[model samples]
Target chain A: MISIRWFLTLTLIALLVLVSFLSSLRGYRESMAEAETLFDLQLLEHVKLLGLLNPASFLFGNTLVIADSVITTPAELELSLQLLVVYQIFDREEKLVIRSENSPTENMAAFEPGYQHAEFNGYSWRALVAQDPLDGHWIMAAQRNDVRYRLAEAVTLQAVLPGVIGVPIAGLLIWWIVGLGLRPIQTLAASVRAREAGDLNVVELDDIPKELTPLTQSTNDLLTRLAMAFDREKRFAADAAHELRTPISVLKVQLHNLLHDLQSRQLPDAAVQTTRQSLQELGQGIDSLAHLIEQILVLNRTTPDQYMRQFTRINLLALVQDVVSNEFEQILARDQIFSLDGLPAFVSGDDTALRSLIQNLLVNASKYTPLGGQITITILQEHNKVLLKLEDSGPGIPEQQYAQVFDRFYRLPDAHHDASVTGSGLGLAIVKHIASMHQADIQLSRSQNLGGLCVTVIFQAYQQDNPA
Target chain B: MIDAVVIVLREVLEAMLVCCVLLASSYALGAKRIWLLPVTLFAVGGALLYATNLTALTDLFDGRGQELTNVLLLMLTGASLLFYLAQLPGVITQKTSGVTPALYASLIVASAAAMVRELAEIFIYIFSYGIASGQTAPVVSGAVIGAGVGVSLGIFIFFGLLWLGKRRCLQVSAVLLSLIGAGMMSQATRFLVQSGFLPGEHIVWDSSWLISESSLTGELLHALLGYDATPGIEQLAVYFASLLIAILLLRKLSVNQSLDVDSLRH
Candidate 1:
């Protein structure tokens, strides 16, 4: 589950930092260019001012413009050449005429009317020298090269540092903004989560984000589909009931009338026995119909999706014992030997669903087994799994029919032809559904000892904290 | 900030891209939700490895623990990817049930190993930079941006692959995925060379003049295709061997699927 909020916030912060950094880099280059241009103009202006000084001041061969600017000794802050301007006047013979107090008696540059670089002592200077045509004297004005570079760096840094410092503040803002943008989705999810279990109603959010509309629509689509399926299932049961109810009721009424008429006619003993036999057939038919309907209903209710919500820790041994007891009468009537085996085994599953599964297996065992047959039901824990096994001494299904037997209302040809045997053919289908719901593995095989059928269901063992 | 983001995004995107591809396939196979289990487990495992390394892990392999761990994870991921790639045979031929268990298990291992390796480095980098420096604003924002962009790009690639797959033969997607797997394994082989566990030549060819490996396009290609600026002979050999095996297996699976379809028609 990737959260949209996390993704968007991370993206927002990254974009901000990247944009800021690139912009600052561009600003640094532009600012340095601007600073260079400003320094050149100042250099040019200083050269002009020195050339315009009085010729006598130049002829005196004395220092000029040095008292106000020169620093024989200065404080740390005043050491920068940003405050110092030095100049010298040179004749055609390259002799020094007049200069600043501390200006070195050296040519800053050749008496050219353009900018140049020169060295004085161990330091480099940026200088512009201009010659006055009237007097044929050269005036050169210069400043330290390091001073200009330092100022350029300062200009760029001043422009960039704020954004660098702003990164964390921008991150916090992005976090809050992204959260605000995602609030609608969060609220929608919370509303959905807080709803009562099993309620698949369409969520009603007054305002929805464009991004989340599709999600909401899809969820609503699922709810609509579920609602439709539920309606169809309900209608199917009702329709089937309505269609079969009249015939069943009519049969019951006629059977009652026939029995009453036989008593009124004072029928002979042999005839009465035959009538009783026919009545027995009718009663069995009714029982099969009722059983079929009940199995159909149970199978529908336990459909994988429907029964997924109901899961609990259930004792397999107890459930098997109950089913065995309920089917004991039928087993005894057929003179079948029934045995129960193993200790209590607990598993995580739906109790009703597992109960139904147990009852069906027991009922099938009783129904299929011959007289004097043996049937065994067992429950045991193997490691972290609980296994439920049922075996009966009867004609087991052939290998080819195992898959077909799981289909709805499917009966073996032999079972269908047998006049004494009765079944609805839905027992195994219901059992399969329940097994699937609990994620239990079910298998059928020939009972090696019983020489008949064996059915086993393996369930995950659910440990319960019960000291009592 | 841009420099920081690019550095972090490079490593993050490689692992993230692999994850996106794996997750897409998992969803296609209808086993998407359960993948969270392995992802979380691997992340926690990586964190524990980071926390316990000096005190415990370095003792096991004589202080070469990191290299050893990387080798193990790479080998595991490679093997699992091979297993997963081969499972399409069962899916294509319908010889087994939907979403084979073997595929699920192998895919989980591959994704988990890859993710753990990548994420551990990221965690170490960010936390080791420290939070109390007051200088971490740029670092933090850059990391956040890198993470966001990497994941966002991964999503686009994932969807693009899926969309292209839907419009074309599945073999195309399979080939792309296999290529990525091969690329990773080759990089792992390079690590072995660097660690002195394998013999290698000096320099195969210097391609840096054409396109430096650290450039944006180079990084993207390196993540997707393992484009080394200078790959040695051993690395190339590993890459080709991995690709050959992957392609052959995918071809075999595709052939089996075709046969199944023909049989069904008959």
Candidate 2:
């Protein structure tokens, strides 16, 4: 039920985001740390340059050195120093000789050659102390902590920006790629869905992916087994019919000869007359058996798998007229009224199958209808579909039994009790199989006109390019 | 950026864990579709409404309203999950074609409740920082990362459960729900204590030194098991008690319900 395509796409995109973004975060942190170290080295280099400035020689005299004095006088000075470095210079004796305006008039750090954190001028600073080797002046250079942190963060953000922006694009590509990778599966499914129930052939796919090989193989194996099973069933029915036909024919002949011989003896005994009646009954039973075998063979031939599928365009009205002409004698013998009325409709189907389908419907109608009842056959072409309807004035089938009657060997409960109607229960089943082979639909309902069973077989009309 | 990622990740993971567990449970029960679309819409709509009215909500109950509301939501989610667990074993063992509407409703409610609070918090956090500081780039990037990890982990867990097969999935889901429900119950107690609804506080222990709440492993554990480095005595009592009740209910009710069904058939 889960769509492998969507699952793979979403999961892959998520994993990409997780891995790439986490790495970017790590890169940002590392870049910031590196930037911080580089800024510290710059601070050290600045302090060395200040040591070379040797500000003590320019002082000329003792300068007032302030202690614990916070610079709060000039707002502009503080604002400038917030983004710039603050520097201070001191003599070897720790007296402040020169200082930036933002710096207090005090030694920023102890007169030692090292870096240290100190609070002065109401701001925290990273101060580096280095002795002027030439003039022995203790020089200090410092940067505000906030300014350094801002610089590091800005630099790192620049490095991590591209990865953040590329995520949406990567997600689109992953979706497309995952769908592309799963194409074979979709193709296999579509091919299987397009097949007919009787078309149990091994599935053929081009460029099958390795992942789907086993699946296709298993499906093909099942199809092969099913096709073989159906073949066995068809052969069994056909073989039994063939095998039983010979013996039943011989029995019929032998009984006919024996009855003829008995009659030719010209005996007037009562037992001889009884023997004649019994022989007649036995002959009828044998005829019924022979009819059953022939029906079975027709059923097997109409099976879609066993059909040859050679189709031709024929006028359905013309075919129905021919079948009615052939079956009219039976309808007349029963004193039943018969009618074949319709428009000329062209249908593409196997000739023999269509003939069999029409004959079975006509026979079933006549057999079920009472004497002097009406049987109607109509063929109509409506909007590219041809509807073949057969109705009879007989005991109509129940609505619930409509679907069941199509099944092979299935008959109505009333049919069993009506000994007058002799049937093999294979008429409608054969009709259904042939109709399906011709790609037609069969619907059984109570006839509105004749008040009995109505069977409708709808077929797609044949479209001809050239009309005479 | 790191702070944004951590904050968003924690909330997303918590919500995703509950959704994944509920989804897995529905899958185990042979549900074809898990009402995902409706559930997501409900959760998101509720979260948006809650975030928009957050100021009004905070003003109520003398500014302890959010805590009290959170406590209620957490408790409701825990109870719903327990109810869902109660029906799982029997339905799974019986091999029903689909989950019953009642069980499905309970799962949807539990997932939506788990999600609304967490999603609202993320919305509030991201928008406030994005508008106030004008730092959209870093914050958005962090959120993207957090949501990615959380969603990915949830998908992994969902598939993992599926791979375990139906029976084992139900069993594991039951145990997982018990633990998660216990965690929610424990969290509810914390919120109550924070609102001063629960009396004086008592510290059970503090293991922040060993595993800080901000670390990666700690955050994952918090989302999965509701791990608290500094769990109070009240939270511990509620956690264990709720856990025990969930386990007992899942085992006893499912078995008894199966027996009842068999008896009725007889």
Candidate 3:
């Protein structure tokens, strides 16, 4: 896939360079054209001057100038094409008359009416031939071949110098400007990433480009729909539970009356025993149903999609520490030695959700562990992640059933066969789902130290600038 | 060095902009993505033509082959753009236009031709001046910097145009596109005169006395809108004709678009 930003930036820069080169090229060509025209004009001016000089002393001057040409060696000044200009004059009979200091002793060119490139002495020359229309005197102005090229190059370089210097600076400015223009998108993405799953508040961005306004609005709309769906789901579960419990309550009352009536009218011992056992099983089944209903509601409420709780910055250690304190009686009732250990780790999460998650894990540990067992909760900041490890002393779960245990209706084989322990089988499922919604990682393993189930949850830890 | 970079950057930006304009227009019409297919095909096509005709093209019309080819491409792009504008929602044959094969096909042809033309120039140029070296390093670095700047600016412009409310955005695009088409046509005519394929009435108006074409502003305007310092009679005629036709087509499209919208509402 092509990254639009990268593609656009690179392509534009290339195009800019090519265009600039073309501009320089044009400059170079134009400069050469101007040089040619200017040199031709100079030749024309020299022809007029040559017409002014009389041909009477032409032999003596030509001899003197040709003698001086060897001494002058004008070609040595390659930098200044100006110093290389050489001119010669001829009478109508093609006899050499006068010449410039550097002019060749030999005739420059055939008496052409216009420009001609020819060789004289040991070098090439660009010579323009102009004849006097009336007096028929001919004047030829010539400059060395290298001189014209050098002049053109110098002019071209002068014309292209600024381009060579300015493009980089312009490019840098453009890069910075592009970044500024594209910042809104980056900012929006960062803002969305920084929040927890529970954060369903409308995103707020100010002074973003007008184009991104609709995108933000749409994102907010999606959040709204999700929140409404969660509300409806939560409402349905609570309403159904409320309506169900009442009928179950009345049914329990009717069962009680039937038992009393049967007891008052004495029957055969075996028959009475069978009726009582049946009544007991029916009551147990209704209790389990009530428990299941409660667990299902909690599971639904804590799922990320249904999560509607508000987050508060809190010391995770302190919060979990309080939970242990509240559940101390239940732990002690099982004759378990419960311990809490860790520093005051900081994190942000929904208060009620975290409390329920902690309580459910604690309850499960206490219920499952044998009498005189040990339960330990550890919390601390590990790197940037806040880790919480809860270990219990009991027969550790089989390694393979670890994942299956988090399923809503899943119970361990041992728990299922042992009728002495009762469970709605939804505790860990709720814990896993809620932890996920909070963006925490959860791992279930056999505790190395306690020789029992270990539940570990890792939260992304962050500190408040000012502790309140 | 700076000159090489700026020249390349300008050409690449032209191609990039052509792609952006077509894609943006396509998205606005709620169409399937077909522009890339044509663009890629034509890029390869253009490359093949350049590669095969390297000698022949250089030798054509007495060594004016590249110029003639560029001129032809520019005219093709202009025609494609005109066709697109003519089919805007309510214009004649509006029923089969907009998101249909006609519209997307034209967009593809227009954008692809522009890209192929520009890319071929870039390929030729980069090769003409080899990699960065003792004499070329500065130019190469300048090219890199220019690339960054050009792409950044292109993105800014692309997003900025997209941000403009839909109707107005398309309108602004239409206007600029007309200017661009006309500019290309004018440049082609100028080349034609240069190649002696057309009569030269040099200096229809001499703006060079006021501002030389070699100056930065002059070069920039020339790149963006083909502003010539001393435009010839042929260039003026072609530029005006292209511009007028585009304007007329755009007006017709705009009027028809409103009618289409009203009919839909009813």
Candidate 4:
């Protein structure tokens, strides 16, 4: 829910901006203070220079020169010194002896010995005064407030400019760097996302971060346990089916012996007849159990995860015909009609699984169809696919229950149908597993002509040069 | 530069905070990240449009057009957020799968309206000084700083919400969005009063002595909750009234929806 990309990008940018700006603000203030001091020192130097000039007006005894109009610079001159700075010289009597054109006639300050503020000529000035040690005359040097402020601010701004400009650039760089740092996470996620459902292998990530080691280790541990569990489940089913087979075979043999013994001894009593009927029912139950065990073995062996695949090209029509011929006796016993149709369709799959797939389907059709019912098998190759369809004229399953019937041990309720017709409930589940192993699709619906269940299995047709 | 930072930061913070809460709320409701890109693009486009047309907008309504329009936009955004909040509990309780189209639409409208309102102000502030005075570098730089801080804080809060998990995330987002929606309504009321569309001279209380609205702490609080040192009766009324309506709507929806067996079980 929380993206590291956004978090790191934003927070790092914020930190960079904050630290950069704060430092710049400090630099701006310090630079401004330094400039202010330098300006004051410059003002003092100007006054001292004028004192060292020791103009002739100091010796001209009460004579004053106040030249208000003068032109001394070229038109292209950038600096107008008069507008920026003004100065005045006074005699020992505090009388104005000589002054710049821009200076007022009166004293600019309080005739002081140090720097002071003065308002004259409708402009605020920072004036500094110094005494001439030779004649004790005074020289006052002043700079206008507006000009000094502009100069000071311009100087200070240059120092803070970098910080302001670097933020956006730093933001971009941080975004990229953070993304680079988080690449391992993205790689690990992609690796996990790309895995197949049955792939329970340990996750392998390149250059994984230490922070993610625990997570990866825990995930691998979980996968190891899951693989073991799946193996246990597969082995358990096969072992249980194998264990049940011997007992079931023994029951069949014992039942047959008892039936033979009962027939050999002629019995006309009603009680004896009931015993014979009971023996027949017991034999049917044993047969159902035996069929259930066989189905469980098939299901365990054909499961996609546990089954080892050895694919070879085989004609689907021949396989279906062979299975139908083998199962024809069951249909004949029930007085049901059977037919096999369609061309030879080549498919790539394990021969054992395909044979099991066809045999189970044929057996299921014959077992469910009523006496005198019809059963049809067809194999067709269309486009790049082979389709095997088995239709039976019997009580068809409801459309809604089609998906549920494929689940192991899930059977249709017997209340509405013939209760005598039994099922192991694992036939379709085994069929589904085998079909999936071969990358096939199964569809169940009502047969149009047979008016019963139509089961269709579609498989990719094997090409010689390009095996499916 | 400091002024620029403060201005841009406050606006960006307000908009980003709204986005964070809404994004968290949408995620809680099982909405996908598909809308985020398009919504952001649209919001930025809207901000540009509003900024470019600012002069024409200012000239309307006898020179009071901007304020009135801001009031309308803020009100609409607040109303949209309220609608989203009302649907939050129901969606979380499994009454629907993910966000419904109507809910998603509300989110889009709310996001765009709030983003445009906040970001246009920053664009206007930046462009006016940057272009006119040739101070583009410093002003834009300050904006970048402000935006960085605001977005960073938004991301932090978004992760904090996620760390709280789904149920608590929804609850916190609801509360945050309620306050934000109320703040928007209060701001809208202020705009209305400033434009003379609503008249109010009554100062319910002044807290400037304690927390001056111009201070940094005050500005952050203002961006978060529309903190006013001198709020009028109308402003107070609208703020509390909108907040109360949002809470009441959430309560009603949650209580009514909780009775459904499927909703409660989920």
Candidate 5:
């Protein structure tokens, strides 16, 4: 695609050219007018000068010497020729008196009858007839049109040529100036081009043009975003590495202990029992690894760019009931009391993702709540949105840590010590990401009545007929 | 003629210098493969400049078109300068593997290539100018020579400063960039002024001793620097405000970097 710069430049140059041409034409026309006026003035002056030299004899041809002197002089001949061809003079009876050598070979009788003047053969001529006061004779003068037209042409070309030459030069200068002016943009592009993926630092383009201030600022804004993205990625990788290492280390240590016991040939009953316990611990470690891998997959899938969830109308009450039923095993094992309430609500979301979301929340509540703690899942319909509330009678999250819980791999400091209640720490982040993709909002608060953590997922409401 | 050629040559040489710097930097940073990006851009820019004979293009737009073109050119120059200034620090601080070094070298080469492209554009401009003016070869040739000398001198100055600054163990890239940015902003502002998009107060202050609007020198200065003796109010305001903003931004950046370093030390 042609960039805006080139498009703009070409458009500008074209506009300049057009303006130049019109102005040049106008200028040409003006000059032509001026030339005509000047020529008319000269003609009038010549007529006056001749009239002062006894116009009657000159008109009647009695003053032959004077007439020949005026017409035949080299200067006078040259001046007449320079002005145009086809000059003529006539008497009152319309008798031809004087004619230039290059005058058209037409019968004088034919032209004498009519006083009408017109242009012919690429030349415009003016004819004037005046009667002599002394002899009752007439005088006429006529000249060709080429001189005026030629002057006009010359004026037009002169007016246009500078624009012709100057515009391109100006254009080139403009291009160069544009290039120079765009030097900062080029510099900006180059700067951006020069950056490595790891380099998300701020761009400090100190001397940018005013026109490019917005561009520079936007570019800087992009850099800030990119930096944030990079930081997030780096942190994610670090957290993953740290989290994965613990289980692997535990498995390694258990295997090592079993090998040491076996090597000592001290296969006492106590030693056998200890080896079995070590094997069980290793199995548990492997299980944790599997769970971590699953969480990672979920985390990756939940990335907005990776996969888009299909939205369909889902019954909130039914979805909640299903999730609670699925988590009954864990709830029963932990002896946590679970209940559901509220009306049937409809929400727009991907069913599978929603189920996963609800299941995770329920599992999280089950795990975090103390034994025999009560869990309540409620579905409520509000104006334009459906709310799914999951409340647990566990130790409520600290107010400060509520926001942090949604961050990937963020486990509360106290939660880290409980190895019995293992978690991948990506559940809330996955939920948040999925929620965002569905245009839903999730919030954490202290359950006023439950005296525990209350997590709410708000979804856009769906009408019964318009499922989408 | 000399004037035209000199202008062409100057622009080309400057373009080349930038290309060289980018290519060298790419090589140093081990990112040689990416050289094609700048090369492609330069080629596109050159082809566009050459194919659209400046005169014909300007003629099409009518009288005010020339001023518009001038403004566009000025703005482009400013943008490029600012961009370079912004990236200087990163280029200096980046750790280069072989690939990175190559990339840097390519970037410098691309800059040089762009400069050469500009040179070609300059020649076209001069030639077109000559044809339009109906001037004889002598005049055209003189302009060309003058332009060439100007370009050579500009290159020399650019490199000389680079070398001197390097020798002094100072990263003059940032400073040089700022200057270039300031210059570009001034040019762009001037274009806006001439195009009537902004008021005549383009010049913040006119203390030109050698040139006044009534003098030939003043006309030359106006052509070269986008300087006007009596500028419009808005133009000056925009220019000064932009300059101040750029300076403040740079200062803030520097302060931030220093604070980061201090915290890191702790």
Candidate 6:
């Protein structure tokens, strides 16, 4: 997943760049418009100024040049002219009566009935024609469109240039600002990163950014969970190690004592038999320890995060039949009858994990059941789930003990606790984890018909659209 | 208007590429709880729009208000950069997961929001510029088109870079993020300087040989790199100092990485 910090930075930069870009554009447009309007206004003013100077000049058909003293001189026009290009006046028949020196294309005949825009001599032009009522002649004026547009272009450029520059700059600034803004997050990250794997203390929240409070809190929540899980695993490992070490140490001591006794003297028949019996018992104890160690390792591997087994679709009926058949010889050795009931069931899960889960259930059932006890395995499809039931004629778990049985190393007080019985107290826990990985649930209850323990696992049925 | 739209489309497309990379990486890792990625994107996207509005609102206020807002934004940007960098190691070293679909979706939404916000701002600027320039539609259109093309090109390049980076196993997400962050920081500084909160005459030294600010190309480069045409002593000094500091920090971080690698080998 993208880190929150990077996400925020990207977002902020994107926004700033966008704003800067648009603003620059807007600025350019505005300046251009302002230039155009100013040009139009100046042109109008220039026309008005000329009109005042020679009110009757057109009628008289004479160059009505007012003396410098009587009219506003051209020198006076220069100040206002700074914002405009060439301005001119044409008389009736579109003859140029008064014109600016820079004006190109003197043919006034081209000036049509309506206002027209033209580009000539590498310069754009806008001309207007109007009838002079007092003079009884057509009056026309045209100005270089370039001059107006150039000024507008300049203004637009000036206005937008900063934005063009500023956006990336703004983007950079935003990047830095975002960096500063995310300092708390960085601090949080640094604090987290600096931590040892075993450290799970609450992070300091005092300097966190307001925007990142939720994130920090969630991280802290995750840390709390990790800390708890870590602690649980550690304790479970320590407990298992301690329990198994004691049994192994005792077996070792007994074996050593038996060897020493044999070496010390020629033993009587009774003594020798007793020594042999002691050795056998020690062997059993060592076997139990080895079994317990194996169980603990299995339990550790089956933890949620560690369950990385590849899953595949398998026919539940076929798998169950295979497992039962493989165990048939063992079942017969114990004088137990095995029966399979129900139709073929299909499910998706890790083959190994599923096998282990079934194996544990069957073993548990077989261990508690008396000789000649019958074991039944049934797989049924109901609604949107596959339910597998393993029931045996054994002393069933109590209602309260059902939940406890799933706990690692938990053993019920009333249940069979024969020292010779091979059990590591981890089978049910492994089964629980495997079921969970497949999105399945397991329940333990008494088998009504068998007067024995019933272990049922229900898994969500795989649909074509939603693969497991 | 169409030009402005194009620019917005381009920038949004770039953001889309970054989002896509992030999503793909997450998916490859098989991470559960991936939905958070999209939700985060939406939330951040909304916040960005709000920030733009905040910028405008602050502008309406007195100088102090604007300065305050700018400072706040600057601080936010800086913090974000540091935070992102600090998380880089975890992201790179951790096993990849498949939690990217939701993340990508969110990023796309966020990027889209950012694009729209920017487009609107450009439109407003264009309208105002038009009014100022005597309502010349062609000039306004040209500017809009220029901006649009620029943004589009940026997006295309970003995606192209991402693709190349992916092929090289270069972690494009982090690199793009850093570049984007740098761009934002420069933009913030420009605003501060233009507004007169930051002094302009902070020139540390003149380094205009590579890109003189007077020419058009130089100006473009200056805009991109926070180059001052006529450097104020203060502006130049601040610029170089910041660059040096950033470089040093980066070096230190790289060194840390090497140290980590060495320790792992041991």
Residue B110 miss distance in model 1 (angstroms): 21
Residue pairs with clashing backbones, model 4: none
Give the Å error, residue A9, model 6. 26
Better by TM-score, candidate 5 or 1: 1
- Pairs in steric clash, model 1: A14-B145, A61-A97
Worst 10 residues of 2 chain A by lDDT: A59-68
Per-residue accuracy of model 2 over A81-134 as CA lDDT, tens digit each: 465666777666777777766677767777778888988877788888888776
lDDT of 2 at B165: 67
Whole-model Cα lDDT of every candidate shown, in order? 0.76, 0.82, 0.74, 0.82, 0.60, 0.60
Q: List model 5 lDDT by residue over A212-328, tens digit each.
A: 889888878998997798668856865775677777777778777766767678578787777778777776777777667666656554544323435677888988888777779
Error of 4 at B188 (Å): 4.9
Summarize candidate 2's per-residue lDDT along B89-207 as a digit string, tens digits. Answer: 55554533547777888888889899999999988988888656776777777787777777888888888887786556666878888889889999999898888888736888899
**Model 3: how far residue B1 lies from native, Å:** 12
Interface RMSD of 5: 12.8
What local lDDT score does residue B244 receive in model 2, on the 0 to 100 scale? 87
Judging by DockQ against the true structure, name the best candidate. Answer: 2
A457 Cα displacement, candidate 4 (Å):
1.4
| Preferred candidate (lDDT higher): 3 or 4 | 4
Candidate 1 lDDT tens digits, A1-468: 246686677666666766776666577668878988888898788777776677564454465443445456556336543646678887767788777765777676777777888888577888888888887878888877867776676556666667767877988988999899889988998989997555768988988988899999999999889978887977798578667767877887888888888778877999998988899788779878877877876776676555665677778888888877777898889999999999988787788888899999888888888889999987888998888889988998897888888888888887533457888888898888788778888899999999888998988888675211
Worst 10 residues of 6 chain A by lDDT: A59-68
Candidate 5's displacement at residue A402, Å, is 4.0
- Distance from true position, residue B116, model 3, in Å? 27
> Which docking category, incorrect, acceptable, medium or high, applies to candidate 5?
incorrect
As a whole number from 0 to 100, the lDDT of residue B11 in candidate 3 is 75
Binned by DockQ into CAPRI classes (incorrect, acceptable, medium, high), candidate 2 is medium
Every model: Cα RMSD to truth? 11.5, 5.2, 14.0, 4.8, 19.7, 18.8
Find the 10 residues in a row with the least total lDDT in model 3 chain A. Answer: A62-71
- Estimate, for each residue in A93-181, the C-alpha lDDT of model 6 and write its tens digit: 56666655455536542545445576665766776555556764444456667556665666566556555555566657766876787
Task: Return the lDDT, model 1, position A205.
Answer: 93
Which number leads on TM-score?
2
